[model samples]
Target: MSEWLSVCVAISLLLSLVTATAAYMLYSGLIAHINVLTGSPPIKKITFAYKFRQGLYRNCGQLFRESHNIGPKLPCIGVFYDDPNEVPGPQCRYVVGSILSEGEKDADKELQKRYEASGFQVFSFPEVTHVVTCWFPNRTFFSSLLGVRRVYPRLARYIKERRLCAHPFLEIYREGRIHFMGPLARQGDFYVPEVRRAERRLSEEDELHSDSDVSGVDSNSEYSSGSGVLLSDSRETSPADSWVHSPPQQDGGDRGSRRRSSGEVSFKELDWEQSGGQQQQQQQEGTEVEPRPEPSQKSPEAPTQEWWGVSGEE
Candidate 1:
């Protein structure tokens, strides 16, 4: 009988512990899910000490811990620069730090200097008219996780429904709440300098790759500015070569059209052709049409169908 009683007691204790843990989780989620607001948040600006990092955002908890250890009881802020759904986990960018000043309040210059001396960067969010704001309960350590899991989805939905261009999500842990903020205006102001530098580096790399790729093209051929016309690089001296006629890519494009060949058709208009090629432009149907002057009695020396002009005589 005593053995059975002990077994019952053990089972009861296990059930009680499970119930308590479940209850606590539900309570934490409930606390984090409240006070969901999406609009202009009541903040003009914020000054913060930050450490920029690039990688999975889920790993940002370590950053929070580090900031907290250095500046306990201080408000911490996280600026997330990429959507995990759109960007790769390893490529996500974020800056985490402690807030020294916000709005009209005086900054803790000593704390700012301390963080700066510790190799942390000092940065500020510019004043914005509107922002998406929400808060999650920070009653316990688990609250941060719950808040992130709960608030971010709803915040994303709200922004999508309203078509608000909120970006570079900001999370501020202060006063027992994890305040979520994203600017609807001046959204670019939130990106840290590190992010800009990284982006510039990426763009420069892309440009360099494009340059290398373009350099290996056909040695004799080159692409035109527009009109997608393939200009043949034929430079053989023919009877019609001297009277080179190349039309502008567009109807109202530059009146002077240079031939794709080497130093051929360099002149804007030949002596026999009207200035600016206005007469030929009206007769052309498509974008590119070489205009050739008709034979007339006034110029008996006019080149025939072969257009045997200066190059022909030579």
Candidate 2:
């Protein structure tokens, strides 16, 4: 009788422990969800350093790692630009990096410069309004996974229910919490210039590809007329004229096949950009660009800025 009683007590304790643990997790999650629903993320005017990347969001872990390794405990942020369900993983765009300052508590100028030297782009967003925000605890890596899984669905539902035009979702991790924010206004402001240009160029390329497909035009036959030139309506347009070079398609050639994105800067490209940037700064140093006359310039307009395999036509 005593043995049976002891076994029963042990089983009851085990059940109680399991029940308490489960309830604690559930309660924590429930509280976070409720707070997120009612909370407003504080996205004040701030300076940030970020590296933009075009790839799967899952792959953005590397960016986070790099940022954290560089500036541990600094507020880190991830900006996602597409829904995986709607956009292909390969086409998704994102930027991840650390915040340099918020109002006061400014970071060291040298620190900011260091980050920039390491291929991170720096920008400041003025105080913006109509921002939708929420936060989740990030005590562990698992918290990030949990926060993403729980928060996004609620955010989507909330936006859908209210018919809000929030865009370019942001996840800001600071002081063991992740604040999710999406701005209803100035949504375009968050997209860096490179990303904007990339999107525009990509759309143009997609249109061109679709037209070729619809017209059943042989890509090979047209380019054969000239080296890296496309003959359209008796006009020869060299690929070199564009911001990005679209080399003539060679038989089974992988060289010049893949394009480099803003985030994926190569060592050679970095050296070239350093040289180019120095030259550009020198050209405009002590010169007034804001007061330039429209339609008539004393000197020829600075060569249209060209970059990464894309036309600089503006």
Relative to the true structure, how large is the alpha-carbon lDDT of every model?
0.53, 0.53
lDDT of 2 by residue, 1-314 (tens): 99999999999999999998777666445346434443344768778999987655566777888888878868888765544433344654567889999875687798788888899999776556576667777765556655665566566556556645455457788877778776655555666666656645543554465454534443222111011111010011221121111222211111111232233235546666766676677667964333321111111111011111000111
- lDDT tens digits by residue: candidate 1, 1-314: 99999999999999999999988987666544455556677556888889988765556777778888878968888765543333344664567888888888987878778888888898888887777677767776667656654565565556545645455456777787777776555544665777666544543543454445544442223222111111111111121111111222111111111113322233323544563476467657445555553321111110101000000010
Cα error, candidate 1, residue 58 (Å) = 2.8
Kindly report which residue pairs in candidate 1 clash with one another.
none
RMSD of every prediction: 21.5, 18.3
Q: TM-score for every candidate vs. truth?
A: 0.66, 0.58
Per-residue lDDT value at 313 in model 2: 14
